[model samples]
Target: MAVAETQGIEPVDLAAGSEIDEYILDDGVFKGGMSTLRTATNSVDKKVMIKFFVQETSYQRELSSLYSLQKAESRNVISLIDYFEAEEEDEWFPQSVIVLELGTVSLQHWAHGKRPVSEVYLKSILLDILGGLESMYTAGLVHCDLKPGNIMQFTCPGREQGIWKLIDFDCACKYSAI
Candidate 1:
């Protein structure tokens, strides 16, 4: 399938828009320790996952981590699309949104189902994930939160399928050079 296509899944009504204030929030698809993951459709109906932070500090941490990852330029790392902030009526006043490339299912979901993976396939994924971590370390960044839920599995054919992506860098921190 094309990158922009989502099979038969219709674009959700996120009250979506291009700007920060113009965009709308929809129900979260996944909830993490510091953020809730929601689907936001663009003006062109393209779907992107948005990470809404529960606190301003968490947002800052994630934003900084993503910036570091962007500088690392690792193919095994998840890509950052865009980010924005929207006003909230609740205690979380200004909600920070981190836009990202959408993935089908997380490794956590797969593991939860107790699905058996071929040894070769498991090794391939581990190697790819380690490569990403190596790149982060080389760039002086440490991924503090490395788990299945934070890892995205891409099913694209050929080379794309070879490397799974590491995500959820909110807890990632910069370490002093050794």
Candidate 2:
């Protein structure tokens, strides 16, 4: 794996098999506006998704939002497993990393090239999204960047259908009552 020099901060291009601490990157990197995501596994080999924020502001925002949501413990929202800063001296590595529950698929990818769903199924998906929004609102935060790509589909062990949950929160902010 390529390491960044300490002279100046550089963007690290992570590849499959790259290990960051105990988590190992297992798939291709998915780049977003504020961060990059990768499918990884923890020390015990359980699958997880890791997010590396590009900017300090974005990292702090998402970390705060996740911490608040963690207290709320909403089933409609994605769960944060662990978080930490890279200990490596390489400036190319992202300063902040967040480990999250891996989803079966992103809503955007799940919807692509698929047939239209029943009204009940569509309503279920909408209701799940609404539930997530309600949880965020109740937690005094607003997800400013709601989109299909930010929604994840997960399937529980005993459930037949998938459950949709809100994921990204870098664009989220707190709200105060009037």
Candidate 3:
């Protein structure tokens, strides 16, 4: 879908079957206040989520945090698969793109749909979130936004429960910056 320009940032004109690099865009598109998210598949047909940042500052903040967490290989944190800048014709600034692992649902939505979860399941979710926080601390970064909406759940085929992961580090910053 073609997203109209917002806040002086031109959106990437993508539709179903459109190709960006080796990733094929799907029909899914989610527009946010500062970014746009689309579902896509890579060369190997692995499902992924693509985020296009409207502001360079937000893009850089998220990129920095993702890079640090990527090196730590924290399972509790969302994995950053790849990133690049997609330049548009005559556009002074290029759109910053970030490829990430696809998540089934946000923690807020999941909790709202399902009734009270089992105690064990609740414990597991808390532990997973804590693990993500610990990983961030170890990397000398802090996630300024830690809400249910920023937490995602990844469904595992063999596992009884989905894995909870922390996501959206646009507001995150280094400890030294705090």
Highest-lDDT candidate: 3
**Cα distance off (Å), candidate 2, residue 138:** 1.0
lDDT to native, each model: 0.70, 0.82, 0.85
Writing each residue's lDDT as its tens digit, candidate 2 over 44-150 gives: 98989888877878888998998898888888899999887754665556468888999998889988986988888888899999999988988999999998999
Give lDDT tens digits, candidate 1, residues 88-171.
553323466788877777888867866687797788889978978987887788888888888887655676544588988888
Give the C-alpha miss distance for residue 90 in model 2, angstroms. 5.6
lDDT by residue (1-178, candidate 3, tens digit) is 2233232443444647766678888888888878989899999989999998988899999999999998888989999999987567535336888999999999999889687688989999999899899899889998998999999999777767888999999889998743
Model 3 is weakest, by summed lDDT over 10 consecutive residues, at 1-10
User: TM per model?
Assistant: 0.75, 0.87, 0.87
Model 3 score (lDDT): 0.85
TM-score winner between 1 and 3, please give it: 3
Q: Which of 1 and 3 is ahead in lDDT?
A: 3
On lDDT, the stronger of 1 and 2 is: 2
For model 1, what is the C-alpha lDDT against the true structure? Answer: 0.70
